[model samples]
Target: MFIRIVKMSFHEEKIPLFLDNFHSVKNDIRNFPGNNFLELYQDKNNPSIFFTYSVWNEESDLETYRNSDLFKSVWAYTKAFFNDKPQAWSVDKLESLP
Candidate 1:
């Protein structure tokens, strides 16, 4: 499995708009094919900064999602609220320590 992390910096005033949009589509994202999990996180120091942490079965799965209409729709609206360019990473698990 692999992990996809996206760090987004939103316009402070647009945070609520982002949240509302997320609320409406998060479920569809979580249920997307090849998605293992989905999570949203906010920076304690900066409410305008948020992260999306998700796990996918493989990199190709992530690519597939990125190419889908769902992503196009969600991202189109989501990016309009960004204060800065979003950063993202796709990584494989090296190890897990319990």
Candidate 2:
């Protein structure tokens, strides 16, 4: 599986709106075909900075999601609140330790 990580920074006042939207659609994203996991993380030093960590069965699965209506809608809403351009990366797992 490949891991997808996205870092986003929102306008301070818009964080609540972004979070509410996330909560409303997170389940749909997590259950999407070929998705294995989904999680969200906030930076300790900056409340407006957040990260989305997800796992996909393959890169094509990620591409499919990106082209879906769900992604388009969510991205449209989320991007409106951005303080900066979002950054994303897809990487292979090196190791995992319990």
Which predicted model would earn the best TM-score?
2
lDDT (tens digit, per residue) of candidate 2 on 55-85: 9999999999999999999999999999999
84 in model 2: Cα distance from truth in Å? 0.6
Candidate 2, superposed: residue stretches over 4 Å from native: none
Q: Candidate 2, after superposition: displacement of residue 58 in Å?
A: 0.4
- Cα deviation of 54, candidate 1, in Å: 0.6
TM-score per prediction, in order, is 0.95, 0.99
Clashing pairs in 2: none
Please give, for residues 1-98, the per-residue lDDT of candidate 1 as tens digits: 98999999999999999999999999999999999999999999999999999999989999999999999999999999999999999888899899
Q: Please give the range of 10 consecutive residues that has the lowest summed lDDT in model 1.
A: 87-96
Predicted structure 1: lDDT = 0.95
- State how far residue 80 of model 1 sits from its true place (Å): 0.6
C-alpha displacement of 1 in model 2, angstroms?
0.3
The alpha-carbon deviation from the true structure for residue 48 of candidate 1, after best TM-score superposition, in angstroms, is 0.7
